[model samples]
Target: MSTVLETRNLTKSFGEVKAAKSLNVGIGKGEVVGVIGSNGAGKTTFINMVTGYLAPTEGDILFDGQSVVGRLPRDITRLGMARSFQVAQLFPKFTVLDNVIAALVAAEGTKASFFGPFTTAARRKKAEAVLEEFGVANYSRSLVSTVPQGARKLVDIAMALISNPSMLLLDEPTSGVSIEEKFPLMDTVMNAVKKHGVTVLFVEHDMEIVARYVSRILAFYSGEIISDGPPQEVLRDPKVQELVIGHHLDISILGDAT
Candidate 1:
């Protein structure tokens, strides 16, 4: 597959601390890649820089071969890249449908006013379609704060997908979800993204989830990528096991899950 995203010598530093080191990585089109790291690792920093949430102290980022280093987050979104946070970013007070309508308005690059009617019938129908696309239509009229955690995650992902992005960066998609719900939640997300042929880069801590969903793994240690390869190979790497995974796991079992 052709390269969809590339970071060349990417570096981000906050004063004396290096959140991201001189990193170079490339993600191919339609690849499902998992990012794993400990607390101080640069996983989130990498996502932030790529998504334009943080300016890189050095180096460049390219989305589909175009430099997005200095682009605004919305501008990057307009370029067909979208991201969901570890904590679902949603309008807590808005009805789920209304939340999606707001996203649709922003995706269209139209200025949305507090007093204006942003939700036309066509927009509402589109929002409903998005809700159904992620299997969250059942919560269409419910407040975002009142839904289950899994539903909230789906709602956030649905909002991201409404923009029809070619590449989606998901920050810990299964965080705060119960174990029984994690697989189903990931299944829903993977299915939706695959339907759109979207490339995915997700930060995940769960070994099973990472092994099951991603074709490749990127393991970060202290702001640097220490391992990058197929899931089984990276998972079984002794250094990765000691520093990241923190214990030996039978890759055969994880492979079976995949």
Candidate 2:
């Protein structure tokens, strides 16, 4: 498989603290990879740097074989890379359909104005289609804040995908979703992404979710990757079990589940 994204000696620092240290990794086109780490383990920092939300103190990011370091997030989005936040980033007051229409406007790179005639009938039709694809069409008339967390997350992912990005980075996609809802939500997301053939890198705290969704895993610990391999191999690594998974997950059970 060809590489879709790569980082070389990526580093980020806040004064004396290094949130991400010399990180180097590559994601293949169409690969579904999961990122696992505890809080402050540099997972978000890695995503932030890759998406241009935070300028790395050192190293380069390549997207679709072009250097993207120092590029703005909007520029990166235009380059076929888009991301969703850990918390669903949405306009709480706007109805779900309107939020999607707004994303469509942003994706077109047209300056949005309160008095501008941006939301044409074509835009509304496209937004509704996207909502239906993500299985959130029922919540279209509801305010985002009034929707369930899982639905809100689906909306956020849909917005990221509005630009037809080749790569989608999801930060803690299952976080805040109820346990019963997590699998179905992810199934919708995974099925949609697979249909579009988009590469995925998601940060997840749920072991079961990670195990089921990703073909490979990157285990992060203290600003570095402790293990990188197939889910079973990485989860079974002693270093990963000791440092990342810790006492919370039993490796044997995870092994059987996979």
Question: lDDT for each of the candidates?
Answer: 0.92, 0.91
Total clashes for model 2: 0
RMSD (Å) of each candidate, 1 decimal: 1.2, 1.4
Superposed by TM-score, candidate 2 places the C-alpha of residue 43 at a distance from the truth, in angstroms, of 1.0
Off by over 4 Å in 2: 252-258
**Candidate number achieving the greatest lDDT relative to the actual structure:** 1
Q: Which model scores highest in TM-score?
A: 1
Per-residue lDDT of 1-258 in model 2, one digit per residue for the tens? 999999999999999999999999999999999999989999999999999999999999999899999999999998999899988889999999999998888888888784678679999998999999999999999999999889999999999998899999999898899989999999999999999999999999888888888999999998999899889888888898888888777555455443
**Model 1, 1-258: lDDT tens per residue?**
899999999999999999999999999999999999999899989999999999999999999999999899999998999999899888899999999998888888998795787889999999999899888899999998999999999999999989999999999999999999999999999999999999999999988899999999999999999999988788888989999988656666565444
> Which stretch of 10 consecutive residues in model 1 shows the poorest summed lDDT?
249-258
Task: State each candidate's clash count.
Answer: 0, 0
